[model samples]
Target: MYVAVKGGEKAIDAAHAWLAEERRGDTSVAELSIAQIREQLALAVNRVMAEGSLYDPDLAALAIKQARGDLIEAIFLIRAYRTTLPRFGATLPVETAEMACDRRISATFKDAPGGQVLGPTFDYTHRLLDFKLAAEGEAPVAPTREASQEATPHITTFLKQEGVIQTEVDQGDTPRDLTREPLELPADRALRLQSLTRGDEGFVLGMAYSTQRGYARNHAFVGELRIGTCAVEMEIPELGFAIEVGELELTECETVNQFTGSKTEPPQFTRGYGLVFGQSERKSISMALVDRALRWEELGEDNMGAPARDAEFVLYHADNIQATGFLEHIKLPHYVDFQSELELVRKLRAEAEENLASAAANTVPEAAE
Candidate 1:
């Protein structure tokens, strides 16, 4: 029961004013700029872009600043803002093979076609924090290298060539956009990938972790993980040709899972693919694992009754925006509904007490006799 409470316009306005004041903080302290957030807090901006399904780093940074460093709140702001934008035509699919990779690594092989290029990553850094960063001195410049023009072939291609991995078949159908259309159950790989890419990082990570803990345990090896910039092309109606619209920073992950074979079919490795906006390696890897787990039916494997294996459960609960909305609705004025539940509980307790008293009285009379 949603009872409309009236007459708090002034209070609401004052509260918003106070919030703005608090967001500004002390007068003596220097205010943070949007550029500072965009550059320094790049990871947060990337997360907001990935989950919000928007690729604008500037807008993401602005949202972060507006949200006072709360990432989920920032994502919420980005998502709300995304609704007002006009729909443009879809771009051509990005080619990861021709990506100008900043970082590329394969755990499955000792070395791959492109070789390992470990770019701006904290993988090798010590966990200890450097207090020198607090003093705000000039930071040491990182060594630069000439950008490689060579194409980095996908690691899964090698396995596929060896006839060890299952090959993917392109249906040449347009993928359904959940943003434009409502998500129906029994979603295809394309729809599932879309959901996972835009899904809550934490939720998806948890689901992926669940699979690793023997819940539909598929032995997955990271075939390749690449982060780089790729050109985006868009088709022009007048020219009848696609033109390069922009470039996007993306992280792509490919996982080679355990081989599946039967009496008739030969053993072949199954593959899981993940691609997301910006340099979101963790999210991409998690997406791959969950993607593989969800493919139990398609892969002709037995359903292990795992939450990750349940497409409906995973897809429905994966979105943080939807989950947050449903969860936060309880915080709103539910006075009528709560009061009804409270009254019912009290009535049941009172009835039980009355029954107990009646039984006690009957027992006392019997004892007296």
Candidate 2:
């Protein structure tokens, strides 16, 4: 007779209280405010917003704090919260070029129309730990970069002038959201990028690094990496016009990759694109590289069967939230299945032992006879 396990209600309540305590940590230490998390842990908040597909920095920060700095948990919280939030309407395509540039730069050109403004990058900073920061010392003043009136056009656009790079038609179409929909194989550019943005940063970086190191050698140049706030516009049919809804921080990366001429087409340099939430340059760059690698088949290139080249491989495995949730869920109870397996093994062993004994007895009797 099997008895159903009870005490889940009490266990759950107790766990909730204990989790609250754990999240709070030391009783004497001052509790972390959502604002403090939002301001102090801005980058974490940014990553959560980007990956979570939610735009609210404050809520992301709060989730981070609530999750005790577990970024994946924070992302999960943001995703869950976003589901309940009322959707006013879909926003028009964000003009990233027209963004209020916080950080903008071009590697392809020495000087672009919008001159390279290396804004808020850790690129040149020494990797040494500061003793003063250990005690929460005052931060250095923000350095001002002079803004340029002449808008710099995208480097890829310039390459397209001579028919060097693949020209993309601005579908100006609606892009898909991977968070809301289940990811299917053979994804479009928009869907692939969405998966990569919320993807395991380390995994994406390694795959991108692999392409650079010759797993699928696609020579790529970083045409541009831009980070800034862009206004989100939404059209209201009732009002008969699109209005500025709000602004969001975006990190956009454009890469130029080498491509061979197709049988029916002339040789051309191909373009790979990546756009992420917050200032996720690493993710964006990695995404661009992977994006280029995936397009090899479409461009009529040879099949190298690289990790990045496999759409089913990259898209299916990139999501850390899904990976971790499934991986970590094994810790939950499955004793019934375990016991069943144990019983089957025991039964099999007993039958094998009986057979062996019978064979031995028969052999001994035959020899005696």
Candidate 3:
């Protein structure tokens, strides 16, 4: 029979009280509201929603507050809460062509149909800190222009028409949901993208960076990267038609990689794709690179033993919740294991000394004889 340690409830309660105090340091300062967090820390809220697989900004803000600004903890909270809600039906595939794009850029083309709209970006800004913002100085209004209403054609489509890029043949198959099912090896492109979308932003970024450093170099160029809102629609069984459920912000990245033609095919530019919830451009870009790296078999490219090329490794280590749980569990009581190890070491040392002493005694006797 084994007896476990107790007082978890009492310790947890006290810890919670201490945490609340720490969260609101300096009583004279005003307490932050969920609304303020939603509005002021919009980027943080967006990240939580993106990684959590939940799009509710309000709930994400609340989770952030409850977690005391730990983004991973907030994401875990959102994911846990999301699992409890009853799933009715899935929406149809979102149409990016009809997206109300706010920010769109293409590196492959000098100019695209809608042109490069660098909306709300930190690009070209100096990294020097402005001390004027310390006093909450008023900022100048940003210049704006009316956006074009024309449907933005994908940059890859242009290459496809020119016969310079490989056309992806759509194999009509329902994509597996990672949220509902256990991740299996040799995942399809859809499953790999899903994992990458919900994967840790830093981890994915590192993996992508490693590829550039020659782990599995795929000469990649950003074909197109767009950030905007797309309408979601779901088919109603009774109504016999699809209706607009809601609109969500999305960041989509498409990478054009140079693929040397195999025996069966001609040389062409292949593609790697990423679509993530909210304006997570960095994550989306990294996802595309990692996605292409993992598709070695499909692309007829050498694996080159890259970490990012391993689907099993990337998917398994992607989840922050799983990583945190396994990592943090090491802090738990290991007295029994430690004691067993201690005893074994002591026994080994004692046996070694006894053997040495016996050998010395036998040597002395032999010499005297």
Among these predicted structures, which one has the highest lDDT? 1
The lDDT for every candidate, in the order shown, is 0.90, 0.84, 0.89
TM-score of 3: 0.93
lDDT of 2 by residue, 197-283 (tens): 888788888889999988788789998888887789999999999989788888899998777788755688887788888878898
lDDT of 1 by residue, 1-369 (tens): 446678679878988999999999997999999999999999999999999989999999999999989888889999899999998788988888999998999998886887998898889999898999999888898898755667889999888889898888898899999887878988999999999999999999999999999999878999999999899999999999999999999999999988667544468888888899898999999999999999888667778799999999999999998999999998878788888998899999999999999998888444665
Specify the poorest-scoring 10-residue window by lDDT in model 2: 144-153
Cα deviation of 131 in candidate 2 (Å)? 0.9
Better of 1 and 3 by lDDT: 1
Per-residue accuracy of model 3 over 1-369 as CA lDDT, tens digit each = 345668989998998999999988889988889999998888899889988989999999999999999999999999999999998989999989888888999988876866899888878789889898788878768887654556788999989999999889878688999888888987888988988899899999999999888999867999999988888999999999999999998999999999888766679988888898888888899999998889887767778899989888889998888899999988998879877888899999999999999998888444665
How does each model score on TM-score? Answer: 0.95, 0.91, 0.93
Model 3 has an lDDT value of: 0.89
Worst 10 residues of 1 by lDDT: 258-267
Query: Arrange candidates by TM-score, highest first: which order?
Result: 1, 3, 2
Overlapping backbone residue pairs in candidate 3 total 0
